[model samples]
Target: MSHARRLQRELQKMHQDVPVPGITMVNTENFTQWQMDIEVLDQNPIYHGKTFRLNFKFTENYPIEAPEVMFVRAIDREIPMHPHIYSNGVICLDLLSSGNGWSPVQSVESVCMSIQSMLTGNTKNERPRGDEQFVLGAGRSPRHIRFVYDDPTV
Candidate 1:
C-alpha cells in the first residue's frame, strides 16, 4: 500500500481504539512527520508523572524502512533516563532500526507499546554511558547512527 494510504488507515485505527493510557497522537499537520505523547503508566519513580513527546519522521519507503523516532523536549515532556535512551532523545532500541528488528507488520501503536514496555521494565535512572559525548557528537537524525543492541532485556 502507498505510504499515505497506510498512514491514513493507521491514524484511523489509532482513533478507533482507546489509546493506551499515556500514549496520544499529537500532530498530523503533514503525514511525513508526526508527533505523539507517551507516559509510563506504572509508578516507576524514573518516569513518575512525566509525559514524553516523541517525534516520528516517515519516508516514502515507510514500513519497509523504519521511521526515525526520538523524544522531544517540551514543557512537560522530558527525556526519560534509560540505558538505551540518550540525553539528546536518541533511542537505541533495535525495534526502531531498519537493520534487523523492524518489520512492515509493526505499526505506530505497536512501536508505542514496545517503548512503553521498555520504560515499565527499566529500573535504572541513568542515561546511556557517554550520553553527554554522544549527544554532543550525534547528528540531527537518530537513523544515521548504527546503535548496538547491546542488551536484550531492559
Candidate 2:
C-alpha cells in the first residue's frame, strides 16, 4: 500500500482499538507529522508523574523507511531523564534507527510503547555523554545524524 494509505490505516486502527496505556495520540492532523504524549507508567523515580511529548515526522518512504521520532518539549511536558535521551529531545533508541533496528512492521503505538519501556527500565538521571556538543553540532533532523547504538542497557 501507499504510504498515505498505510498511515491512514494506522490512524484508524489507533482510534478504533483500545488505547495503549500510558500512550496517547495528541495530534495527527496530517499524514506527514504526528505528536504523542507518553508517560512512564511504573514507579521509576526519575520519570514519575512526568509526561513526555514525542514528535513523528513521516516521509513519502515511511514504513519502508522509519519515521523520524524524537521527544519534544511542550507545555506541561518535559523530556524524560535517560542516558539515551538528549536534553534537546533527541532520542537515541535503535527502534527509531533505520539501520540498527527499525522495521516496516513497527507502528506508532509500538514505538511509543517501546519508548515507555525504555524509560521505565532506566535508572540513569543523566544525559548521553557529550550531549551538549552533539546537540549543538547536530542537524535539525535525527535522520541526518548517524547515531551509534553502542549501549543496550538503559
Give lDDT per model, in order: 0.87, 0.89
TM for every model, in the order presented, reads 0.94, 0.95
Write down the worst ten-residue block by lDDT for model 2.
138-147
Against the hidden true structure, what lDDT does model 2 obtain? 0.89
- Model 2 lDDT per residue over 1-154, tens place: 3889998999999999999999998999888999999998888889888899999999999988999999988889888788998888899888888785899999989999999998888888999999999889877678767788788676
Question: Model 2 off-target regions past 4 Å?
Answer: none
Number of clashing pairs per prediction, in order:
0, 0
Give the Cα error of residue 88 in candidate 1, in Å: 0.4
Error of 1 at 11 (Å): 0.7
What is the clash tally of candidate 2? 0
Task: Tell me model 1's lDDT, rounded to 2 decimals.
Answer: 0.87
Q: Each candidate's root-mean-square deviation in Å?
A: 1.3, 1.3
